[model samples]
Target chain A: MAIFYILLLFIITAAIIAVETKNLLSAVICVGAIGFGASLMFLFLRAPDIAITQIVVEVLGLIILIRVCISRELTFISGPREFFAVVVSVVIIFAIFLAGIKVLETLPAFGTPIFAEVPDAASQTYVEEGLRKTGAANLVASVILDFRAYDTLGEATVLFTAIIGATVILRKKTKKLLEEPDV
Target chain B: MKGMTIIVKIISGWVKVLIFLFGIYIILFGHLTPGGGFAGGVILASCYVLLMLAFGREFVEENLPLPLASKLDCVGALAFAVIAILGLVLGGSFFINFLYQKYLPGEALNLISAGTIPLSNLAIGLKVATSLFLVILVLSMFRPDMSGDKKE
Candidate 1:
């Protein structure tokens, strides 16, 4: 759709600005804009859950990034090596784009189910029997929480580990300070 | 960090409560709605972050102290584990919907009928909200050197 293209354009523009901006704060803001645009695209694609997650995660990430940026000098002018790296990345992106176009041509048209050629048994089962099995109105929630719960548990553990690591690493000085109060 | 202007503080004081309520609603209605534990938890964390931004770290800490946040984080994880362990005991499988068929009738689209799914969501929401708040709080506590020099 035209709206998708418009959102894509906005995303591309924001991403470029995020990458090219000298000021770290502006770059962070631009990155947030890109996230917003991408979440809108996700919404257009009818994945409301993904969109909500994406937007919320993006906001949280933006806040952390802004906090980090605030603790340091903002100007981040790219050096010659960084410019060269950018050029190399652009070339790689173009190559990938060309390859993707060729690959996409061989595939089904956009919005057409790729598994139409072969019956999507997995998704069909989830769609038809998911409610009966899980009793949740939201199929995605049922799938994640009930069906693929082990994966969710693993993700939760990962989050816990990450927080613990961060706390241990960042709180080292505070721990030392607390231990040696006389100093 | 010193907070923003008085106007921002006043507005955030009013807005934070609504944000927390909305987050709870999202978590509670997760099985029937788009948002689940993670999204709702992030929103809840954002409410706290907003309050911190508007009313300084000290004020925010006074309300939800670091120790309490840490305790909640542990409690959330423990709750989730206990649920999973219960499922294992009841259904012979980890994270099984054991309560769905036996105790609670499988009534479609009802809030209380989702069995352990809503319980899991609540646990995850609590864990995520507290952990995120802790991360932000700890990060904010650090007074990093702005001169690009390593701390001795």
Candidate 2:
């Protein structure tokens, strides 16, 4: 327990260093390390699934940050703007932490698994008899892919739109490139 | 070109193999593990990025052209939609695995028993990897001319 607090302190310090740093590349690295530390904390909290997802997403975020850092346009800094941003972020973080701790303390502890509270009605029937009815082996997968399939389709469409938007932006850049001739 | 070191080459090769194997493991075991299609696919792309960093973008672009990667992206997405369509045509809901009982046989908890779930994961993995590679390649290929910018 003490070790966890120590790790949290170290992570918070690292994050502050990252936010205050002038060098973009080193700041990005520090941020990535902080993300990794948060994932470790999640794992310690017995949520390996969340930890894995966090690690994968943060790694990709770091890669994107590194790519952006390499661009010459990202070199400039605005001191006052950055300082205010930090202050706002710190206030928000502290408020969230306090609220979260309060909420955690008030929550009733179910000695058994939390899912036991879910009455055996619609959801239970779906999980157990879904295979027989829907011919899917995995109930959760069936629920996600089959039962809630429309949501999946909607998600895919959102991704497609984002891709199109990105392509549009990139195409404009390519057009600008082609317009210029080397003297 | 002259700054090539033996240590870097050895490490790059090892990283390549590790990334490939890790990606495959993550995608294959996604049903029973913490990983899924998106995670596995990003890992696969990271390998290419790592290779590009250690060697150069030329090595990657030569091996996997932008056009081919784009094609892969389209095909993967089409394959995913087709799978969902198959379920819908069978009078089941879209993306439903209504045909698993006949062909696939295993316990529900087993890794391979998820039927179309695994297939969808593979599709998503392919789509993500190809699209990400294309994005990176296009970004790297751009050479912004400062002289032209100054005139504008």
Candidate 3:
């Protein structure tokens, strides 16, 4: 629809502004707008699951970004070269967008999923037999949690490792630890 | 730092309970709904973030200590692995639906269905929610502007 194109244009414009803005807070807000716009695109594509995740992630990331930006000591130095580079990049991006606009129609149509096109596919099996096979009404949940649970385990491990790394790096030293130096 | 205004605090307090319940609902009904572990977990963590912003770090930390959160994070991830290992032991394969194949085979479209999936959802929800909360809590501690208020 025309409205979808308008939303896409708005997101692209926000990304450009976010990149170019000198004010760090304003730049962060613009980036947040771009993320929300993408989430809207997700909803338009009939993926409420991804849209919910994206919107939550955007809000949390924006909070962290704004908090860090406001509290940190920062300095900015710019030159004319940066401006020229920005202009060149913007023009190139716009040119690509204009060219790619025509190619969009060649892609798969919406609402007609790959499972419908291909018989005996893995996802088609999931869609057709998921409820009885896994006893999960939501096929997506069944696929991820039952048929592909090893992958879920890996994801959980990765999250655990990441959180552990963050905790170790950001941990504040205790007074006792600071008082004693190991030779 | 001191929390924002009384108005913000009151409103956040009222909303936080609803947000927590909503997150649990999403996680619990993941087998029958659009939302699952990750989305629900993030929403649950955001509830803590709301409390942190409205009541300051000290109050929020007192309510849910960092050590407990870290332990819960470990437990959630560990639980996921345990579920997989149990599948291998009981069903002769990794990550098999041993529950539905044998025990607790409820009717279709019921809450009790979905063998290991609901368990996985609960585990992942716990892990993600605690991990996110821990990340934000630790990050907030690095706020240089708020250091001055700690001595008060």
For DockQ, the strongest prediction is 1
Q: Enumerate residue pairs that collide in model 1.
A: none
On a 0 to 100 scale, what is the lDDT of residue B55 in model 3? 90
Better of 1 and 2 by TM-score: 1
Q: Which residue pairs of candidate 2 clash?
A: none
Each candidate's root-mean-square deviation in Å?
A: 3.1, 5.1, 4.3
Candidate 3: residue pairs that collide:
none
Question: What does the i-RMS of model 1 come to?
Answer: 2.8
On TM-score, the leading prediction is: 1
A52-170 per-residue lDDT for model 2 (tens digits): 66787687778777877774665545565577887999899999999999998776663444445678756777767877654445454456555676766666667666655666666
Over B36-125, each residue of candidate 2 has an lDDT whose tens digit, in order, gives: 666778788878877776777778867876667777888878888998898778736666675574556556667767567777778877
lDDT of 1: 0.86
Quote the RMSD, in angstroms, for model 3: 4.3
Per-model chain A TM: 0.83, 0.60, 0.74
* Candidates in descending DockQ order: 1, 3, 2
For B40-99, candidate 1 gives per-residue lDDT tens digits of 999999999998888888898889877778889989989999999999999888888988
- By lDDT, the better pick of 1 and 2 is 1
**Model 1, span A75-101: residue lDDT tens:** 576555777887999899999999998
